[model samples]
Target: MPLLSYSRSYSPTAADVGHVIRVECKATKRVGGGVLTKTVDTGLVLPFPPMPPRRQMLANVNEERLTPRLRQIGVFRVLTYNILAEIYATRQMYPYCPIWALSWSFRRELLKRELQSYNADIICLQEVQGDHYKSFFAPMMEEWGYEGWYLKKSRESMGLEGKVDGCALFYKRNRFILKERYPVDFNELANDFLKQVQTEYDLDYQGPSMAAREMFLSTLNKMRQRLQRDNVAQITVLEVVPANNEMVARKSQSGPLICVANVHIFSNPKFPDVKMWQTNMLAKQLERVTLNRNLPTILCGDFNSEPSSAVYEFMTRNHVPLDHPDIQHPPPQLANIYASLDLEHNIGFASAYASVFGAEPEYTNYTGAISRIGCDYRRSLTEALLLVIRSLDRCGGLRMVHTGDADSVRRAEGTPT
Candidate 1:
């Protein structure tokens, strides 16, 4: 026989929670007219320990008082995470962590458990390896009635072909219908921008300005090469499904649509201008997608920028001046581009954590060397939603929202704390 497989169920009781069970598999086949047998140990398996109680969601006094009214509409949860990639989780990068703890096999089981515990309607993940998404995450989410989209980084291969990491977005299949999806490759955006610039230069400078044009072209090419990092983002539009016929009748026939954008911006600190450019590009893309209709939008991901940074300022404030200090880095030429770049967006976004807790969390990520919160969620879904904020889970960040009622404008009217 080529191969055959079967499964035998062995239900365990509460008594078997911590007990270990050793298992092995044996398979036989014919090779060269002879019989070949191979046995492999699958290793010890133990029922997982009881999970700790979930952390309570923290809401401002005003929101807490309005909880009764909020619950009557609808409730859904969203989570954003930057699961450390296996390639980057090396002994050198994380010396304090045990080698076994960093292995994908061990981490995947724990990640699966942690992810499921949240029971979120939508999940945005960063640093997810291409192979891992295919082999583990996509299938696992499907088993739980979630469909997902994945986009690998678009730069040159890093050592292995399938090891490169990217961003992934998943939503509950029954809760939301996929309306549209946009995979944003920042590298491609850079290329197109440079091409446009080159064409303009060629058209403008035909005679005596040839010398200046040559110099500008040389600098532009250098900038183009520098901008080709493998960063990417995903913009998805989902139409919410009504809970019942009663709600459907109350709400519009089409149901409310949400434009959710997930991004993993470039992490290198040396190029603050690049970070600014990427953030601005995402905002422009959002403006384009939601131009015709004011679809409630939710932007969440690992931005790799701090709350006090220019990127965050532009996102929440909807405007940032050309002279913002954070956009000015050592490379004067590259910095000039961002300094003059338009940083304007009309989509009003309020940070969930800041709105609920009076300020951003102290830390959303932890490691031996550094503990930082380089991610957040911005929402303009106040027309039909109420955000219930939860404390940051070290593994990921979570935000819950209540939807369904369409006439709720009181919550969105006031400024976020």
Candidate 2:
């Protein structure tokens, strides 16, 4: 017999938030001239509440003191979030959280409210499913004066038939103008690697290490297959525009042009080499995009590699030994804004939370019990993600307003930060 199916609804009382509503369905089957009956139980929580009023709550009373210092230079906020794709929330992945509690219907509003609270100028998002992008995020963000750009992984490369998760970039329409956008796919590097290998090898002359040569070729083929499914990066060059008329009068001759590269790198911990390869490709691509080299760049995303990984070291340091065969070129020196604070001590932190708060990194991604339902559960998730946002805000890495005199503003004719 087919498995029994069940559904649930929430009670509208504030007190009903945490209470579980159990749904039972009865199924009957005939076996060996006997009737058998079974009951299936499904539990659902009343998690949704009216959308809270959007507000920005300052974390520190002393934050007001820093406002003048921030005004000395123009600043803008960039927020990166991996809004876990709704379709991928399978029961197997989140065993502790009930499937009903984890449904997109239950989580979307909470996620949207939390994201809107940041009020960041440049927002980078990962794992945004295609349908949700078209039906939800795009139209909704447009209402808030933000333009959204998205690129999904090709289904053929990923071997998935339907919509695949991809990276998204959203910019506040008023604060910045989008100049150029380059969508990078790391898979192209694999083809380049193949060409390099072919040119370096002497196929006509059989060498003494024929067996070793075949083994190397086999590994190359495997790598090529792996690269085809690698995550993509959306590199956008934006010109920071003056937000108000007062700033326009003081605008400087050299308006700031910032290159914001948002990427979700490869995730598998076992494939450190692949991560390095992806990072290297990203660095090369960035160099090509920003030919001037002086444009301040902000690279943000869910780079699956940790702070201790080679990928992290390469991005932050001025130089590193590029001994790996797959790494064809040395990575350009890119500053990790979190680590830039400890330049004198040379003690780099693993995350923004550690760098700013001086505390061990806390869990950014949670898959656990829903201790309290409704707003409490929503607050828990929002607060955890906001910790990073808070750190960035406190450290002066992000600011909502366009501060500083016009002379400090960098302006380019017909250009866009």
lDDT of 2 by residue, 264-350 (tens): 777655565567667667777776766455455667776665444566566655233444332332222111111211111111113
* Residue 43 in candidate 1, Cα distance off native in Å: 11
TM-score for all models, in order of appearance = 0.75, 0.64
> Model 1 lDDT vs. the true structure?
0.67
Q: In candidate 2, which residue ranges exceed 4 Å CA deviation?
A: 1-73, 156-162, 202-216, 246-254, 322-355, 358-363, 366-417
Task: Residues 1-417, candidate 1: write the lDDT tens digits.
Answer: 212234443444465545553333544555556555454533344554444334566534434343422333245678877887888989897676556667888788778988998888989888899889989999999999999899999965578777899999999977887889999999989988788777766776666377787778777878887787889999999877767764554456665677888888887767666877888888899888886786667787877766666777887788877777767763676665554467888877767766755565544433444332133322221111112221121112334332212222222222111
Output the lDDT of residue 44, model 1. Answer: 40
Error of 2 at 353 (Å): 4.8
